[model samples]
Structure formats: C-alpha cells, structure tokens
Target chain A: MPTPILVVDDSVMARKMLIKALPAGWDVEITQAGNGVEALAAYRAGKAEVMFLDLTMPELDGYGVLETLQAEGLNSFVIVVSADIQPLARERVKQLGALAFVKKPVDPAQIEAILREYGIAL
Target chain B: MNDQLLLTPDQRDALQEVTNIAMGQAGAQLAQILEVFVQLSVPRINITESSSIATSILQLVGTPQSVTAVRQAFSGTLRGEAMVVYDQNGCRDLADLMGYEDDIDRDSERELLLDVGNVLVGACLNGIAELLGAKLSFSAPTIMAEDVEVGRLINPQQLTWNYALLVEVHFTLEVRDFTCHLMTLMPEESIVALKSALDAFMENL
Candidate 1:
C-alpha cells in the first residue's frame, strides 16, 4: 500500500510546487489541502502519513495546525515547507513535533533527502 | 528626537541580516508568481520619524507621479505597514508580461498592483515575523494610489508610532523591464520588542 502524504498551503502555486517536488518512484498517495482547516480534516481522516505544511495561510495557519495536532495527540510526522525560513520558524516547528523543515521554493533534492531520512523509500 | 539614535549599530546590523533573508524569500516567491528571474537590489535601512516616510520614498523613486502603490498593515508583537511601489511604465510592462490582453483597463491595472503587492508584502512581513518568533495578522492589501505624490499616499496621522524603521528593496525583472520597490515600516513602539527578539535570536545563534 502506498503511503499517504498531505500537502497544505494557501497558494495554489506553492501547493503545485510541493506536489512536483515529491520524490519520483515513491509509492505515495498525495492529498492536497488549501488551508489549516482542510489540513486538520485531512489528517483526521487518516489520509496522510506525512504532511508538508506551510506556515502562512488563511483560517488556521501552520502553527495552529501543529498546536491542535499536538493537543489531540496525533502522531503523524510533519515536515514544514515554508517560505518563512527563519531560525525561529524552524525551531518552533521542530518543537511542535515536525520531523524536518524545508524552505521554499521547495527543492526536489531536499525533499527527497528528507523523505529518505524519515525512512520513506523513494 | 532623532529616531536613528534609538538603534545601535549592532541592532542595525541584525535588522539588516533579517531583512536580507526576508527579501530573499520574497524574491523567490515573486519569481514563482511571475515566472521570471528577479534581481534584488541591496537593501536600504532607515530609522526616521513616521512623518518622513513619504520623503524617504520620494528620495528613492524621485517622484510619486510615476508610481503605483499598494499598502497593507500588520500587527502583533510587531506592528507596521508594508508598501509595494511600481513605476507606472513598469506596471504596464509587468501586466504585459503577465499576459494581460492588450488595452488593459484601469480596473485591470489596479488588480495587478494588488495581486503583486499581496504576494510580495505578505511574504516579506511573514518572513520578518517568523524570524522574530512572532505571529502577525495582516490587513487586506489595498491600492493606495496610481501616479500620485508619495506624500499624498501616506498619512502621518494613521501611523501608530512617532518613529519607524524602514527596510526597502528594489526588484528588477530584467527580461520584461519591470521594477518595483518593497518597503516595510516597523514602528518605534515595536522596536523594543524587535530588539529583544533579535537579542534572543542572536543568543541562540
């Protein structure tokens, strides 16, 4: 069975970039969410084993998603892929249980490396 | 009171470092939005009274009559406004590059300005806030003026603080001959918080 990955971002352009950057030849089913509300719903529905989250969004943001997931004790691994590449952002996401942080414009090689590190066979 | 005196050399350097990273992120996002390579100019930092903002902008663009401007305000631990200014001719060239049909109307031009402004200003401010470990709520971007004086577009009474820190950068799309300026104004009241945040960030580094 393919692993499910959720990609969340408010920008259509950013979401498209995330999908394009996914590792080739990976047995992965990708789900897309445009904001944090949809992201939470997607996660709760068991549609994602891993999530690529963007910090800035309408409705609920990445931080809000992380906080809610933590409160609910959802154990899915999160990988923050954001244009907000500040050190504080990286630290905060990691503290919130994100497995890794990837700066945007998402680099394919970097995504592949992160996936491999998280034991996803690419 | 000279607002410049409020920031130490170290604080200025730290602010510049943060601005550079933020601008880089903004540039990358902008390139994706426009499907072009963006050339970024060196960032210019100024600490001055809020009333002088228009003067500072005028100095950079020479005259306000040739530019279109968009403004958005953001608040949290930090509070400020971000403005995107594009030369009138540059705005038309950008619309052309974006594949707008010939005979672009006034409404089309305003929409284009707001679209670009939202992307660039929102990204830049979000980047800065992230660096400071702050969450900011942003106002909807609005087109302030089309070919008006910089002074006319800025109202001192609307500023929340008497002084501000301004970070400005110019982006040039060489292929299309499009150029625009992104300016972020952080008010004096927020500088205290910004300085403390920077100190903590530096300490962590």
Candidate 2:
C-alpha cells in the first residue's frame, strides 16, 4: 500500500513545489491542506502517516498544529517544510516532535536524503 | 487595458509565498540582532493607484496617529522603494536595542531607525532577488517621515508610476513589544519582470 502523506501550506504554489520535490518512487498517496485547521482535520481522518507542514499559515499555523499533534499523542512522522529558517524555529519544531526541517523552494535532493536517512522509503 | 494591474491572482499568491521565504531570512537576521525570536505574519500583496498608496499602506500598518518610516531605493532587474514603518512603541523598543534608551535625542533616534531599516531592507530585498534569480542594489536608507499622518506620508506627485504592486510583511519580536512593517513598492514595469519570474518559478512544478 502507498504511504499516506499530508502536505500542508497556505500557498498553493508552495504546495505544488513540495509535491514536486517528493522522492521519485516514494509510493505515497498525497493529500493537501491550505492551513492548520484543514491539516488537523486531514490528520484526524487518518490521511497523514507522514506530514509535511509549513510554519507560517492562516487559521492556527504549523506550530499550533504541531502542538495539537503532541498534545493528542498523534504519531504521524511530521517533517516541517517551512520558509522560517531561524535556528530557534528549527529547535522549537524539534521540541514539538517534528522529525526534520526543510527550507522553502524545496530541494528534491534534500528531501530524498532525509527520507533515505530515516528509512521512510518503500 | 493600460490601467489593468500586472499580476493575476495566481501570480500574486506565488509572489507572496516567495516573499514569505525572503521575509523569513530578514526576520532571522533581526532575531539574531535582538536575541529574540520573531513572529512573522503572512505577507500581503496589493496593487493600488499612486494616489491611494499611502492610504493602503496606512491600512496595513494599522490606523495609528503617527508613524516613523525609512525608505530605501533598490535598483537593478527589480527596482523600487522599500519602506520600513515602525510605530511609536516599536520605535521605543528599537531605541532601547540601539542603546539610545538613556537619552535619545532627535538625531540619534533617526539614526537608530535608519540603522534598522538598512539591515532589514538590504537583507530582505537581497533574499527576494536571490530567490527570483535576479540582482539588486539598494540606496542608503533615509528617514522618510517622522511621526506623520497617513495622508502626508506619501505624496502622489512624487510617484513617477501610475500603479504600484505592494508586498507588505509584518514581524513582531516574540519577547518584546517591537513590531515593524516591511513594504515593497514595485512600479508597473518591475511588476512585469516579477510576473515573469513568478511564472517561471511555478513553470516546472
């Protein structure tokens, strides 16, 4: 079965870029959310085995979503794909249980490397 | 129509996302300087007439009694004036950061704000230019207005362009009361280049 993936960002352009950057044969069924609210709803619907989240968003944002996930003990493998590259932001997301931080204009090589290191491939 | 805005709705969204990443770089620079985490709001894009530019700007920065602003001109593939607006409270916080909290006279206060404007505008504009695969250089930041009303902030006669595409970004210090707005105004011609760049960005995706 294909891995269920959730890609969330407020900008449609960003979402498209992220989807394009996914590993060539990741074998994942992808769903998208425009903001944190939609992201949570999708996660609750069991659509987020692995989640790619953007930091700055409308209606609660990625931090809020991560906090919610942590509070509820949700076990999605969350990778934060964000424009906010501050060191503190990276640390904060890690503390909130995110697996990794990837910068904007998503790099396909970087995505592949991260996936390979984590043994998250098919 | 000649009066039609350059960017379509789709283009605007791409431009905003591009700007958000650039703003993140600028915000990180600010966080390093102040040793405080910065909270960035989503970037807002608008295309408006020169006559009402200040009004839209005022609306974005909130309808405050007075505002201090620093303006710098960026020239190259993308050319425009970038303005950094700071409210009184934020200016006070900046004054403190600049170590002028003890005795900030008029000149020192102006210098302090210009100092911030210089760092932020240079970093942010460079980030945007880099992301768009373009090059840009900026003029020295200058104090554009000191505690002025919205109407007096920008004179329509001084604007050489009929329309400008404004990208407004706001950042607030996480632990302090410091807040500022970075607003970029690109004239119609630059918008054409920006539009092409935005299209190219989304082309392969």
Best candidate per lDDT, number? 2
Candidate 2 chain B lDDT trough over 10 residues, lowest sum:
B1-10
Docking category of candidate 1: incorrect
RMSD of each: 15.2, 1.4
What's the C-alpha lDDT at position A6 in model 2? Answer: 99
Candidate 1: regions farther than 4 A off = A1-122, B2-5, B63-65, B157-160
Clash pairs, candidate 2, are: none
Per prediction, the TM-score for chain B is 0.91, 0.94
Clashing pairs in 1: none
**A-chain TM-score, model 2:** 0.97
lDDT of 1 by residue, B20-99 (tens): 55876888777777877676554677777877877877776665566778989888888888889888787888788888
Q: Candidate 2, after superposition: displacement of residue B23 in Å?
A: 0.6
* TM-scores of all predicted structures: 0.61, 0.96
lDDT tens string, model 2, B1-205?
2544557878988888989999888888888887778899999988888988878888888775678899999999989999999887878888787566568888888887888788889878888888888899989899999888755778989999988888989899877878899998888889888888878877856
Local distance difference test, per candidate?
0.78, 0.88
C-alpha positional error of residue B34 in candidate 1 after TM-score superposition, expressed in Å: 1.3
lDDT of 1 by residue, A12-121 (tens): 54566578778778888899998899999999999878999987666888989999999999689899987555455678889998899998656899988888887876
